[model samples]
Target: MGHPKFPSKHYDTPSHPWQKVRIEQEAGLIHQYGLKNKREIWKANTKVREMRRQARKLTANSSDEQFQKEKNLLLAKLNRLGMLDENAGLEDVLRMTPESFLERRLQTQVYLQGLSSTVRQARQLIVHGHISIDGAVARVPGILVTRPQEKSISYSPASALNSDLHPVRPGIQETFEDEVEGKTQDNEKVKGESEDNAKTDAKTDSKKDKETETDKEEEKK
Candidate 1:
């Protein structure tokens, strides 16, 4: 622990700061995830590394009496955070990527749940105290959301966004209405095709009936 005013950095900077491949990859992630900077990616990568390091240590000490207990605890924690499955093991933990951690952030979750059009908007809503988890405001966009907490994430009751008339609400409503309209159009197209097929079948039956009547008349002649 360091001074309260100047706490330690929770993440490590890359060894080579000028790698072209890495810089390009980081830029893509930042844009795709609407991250503020490369530092967030670095922080997520550091978390993944720490988790993998613990997994490796646990794997090496499989014969220890406390191994099963510690392994279960670690897997449980990861599962609770929605990062791993119930049946996941140390191997899965070792394979975890930084994106796995990033996806669990509140901003990403808000966007994924359709509460926000983008992660940047999600961040803005959270930082402005418009977002909440379980009725309590969460101002940190980078905070990791647990599976249980995720279910309760919504706009704070005090925020104007809680109302359907809010400016942001119209955008979301329009997107939903557009999807509904598209489905309705598709259904109408299918119905039209079915009606056309029925008419064709009826005309074919009438033509066959007329041919049968002409054959009967010729036989009578």
Candidate 2:
């Protein structure tokens, strides 16, 4: 028997060049939003596709009864996303791109709201439980945030606020330490050179003074 966590839609490939093109387009989206992988992108596409199918099915209905039901559900979802206008409909949902999905991702939200400087750091912060929605902590970087929650999203662990979102990340602290030590060494060298210069100047002045006194005595003779 297969293992519980084994391959189930876990190893699949796109069957067409159009699919390849879609994946390429989404890769740009992935990089833009700092997504972890293509799986997240596919999940968003599936949701959008299902919404489109539902809307198309309702469009064929004659009476207002079934249509209104489908429309209500669609509007509710779109409204939650803050993308539903008074006249929003199936066309609006169909028009959504990978960017729309990316915008709702916790990583993208964190970066947009200025909780983290870079997209990658924003992702790390979200995954590390440093972020929250409506006052409830969320540790999943892939969690899609809706509009009302989007405005209310915040970061927590107050002490973590002052620290770098990705503090253990390479390069930053190491570079800072290197620069600080280099400056200290440079300052000490400058101070020592300045003191030596001052002493040399004093000795030169005294030698000149002695020479002048000896010349005066010779003149007197």
Candidate 3:
């Protein structure tokens, strides 16, 4: 075993690192989930890969009681983690994508439950200990949140975010919307200024051209 002082890598690197399509897909996923880097995506992929591998092994040993028991245990764990439904079977586990695993993360769930305005903001709140689950502070955004804990997610009692008047609190939707609208208005103003500048430049160029032509005619006279 490796030294306990240094943690081992949690994800497997891509087999074809130079593949353009795979690179684009990884970039898209990173942005979509507000992931810190491609490593988070790879970690989710690794987890899904392990689950599919186990499901394949169990499928081959369909007659073995021990394998069946282990399979049930695996399914139950996934169900508790909110990665699968109550009626989900081995097929569902086998078909699970990395997105499904990512969606179960506390950060994603916080944004989905409207606790935060965005996934990155949720991560920030979680890491800063503003978030609580089941009355305990949840400092890790990567934690796999269970279905039962979903409803229990809220701002820590001691956190300023727990107050309804907090700027980032979910109850203050108008503040967030106004901020967005303000940015949009600023962008439109900038765009209008640029367009006006372009028109002014075109008119000035035409005027200069006419003056130059008149000067040339006078020179010929």
Q: What is the C-alpha lDDT of each candidate?
A: 0.93, 0.75, 0.91
Q: Each model's TM-score?
A: 0.77, 0.65, 0.79
User: What does the lDDT read for residue 12 in candidate 3?
Assistant: 92
Compared with the true structure, what per-residue lDDT tens digits does model 2 show for residues 83-183?
56657777777687656666777788888887766899888877777788887888898887888888878766552654553554334546676889999
Q: Model 1 over residues 9-68: C-alpha lDDT tens digits? A: 999999998999999999999987889999999999999999999999999998897987
Candidate 3 accuracy as TM-score: 0.79
Cα lDDT over the full model 3 = 0.91
Better of 2 and 3 by TM-score: 3
Instruction: Show where candidate 2 strays beyond 4 Å.
Output: 1-13, 17-20, 162-221
RMSD of each: 10.0, 7.5, 7.0
Error of 1 at 75 (Å): 0.2
Error of 2 at 146 (Å): 1.6
- Spell out the clash pairs found in candidate 3: none
Off by over 4 Å in 1: 170-221
Please give the lDDT score at residue 158 for candidate 2.
54
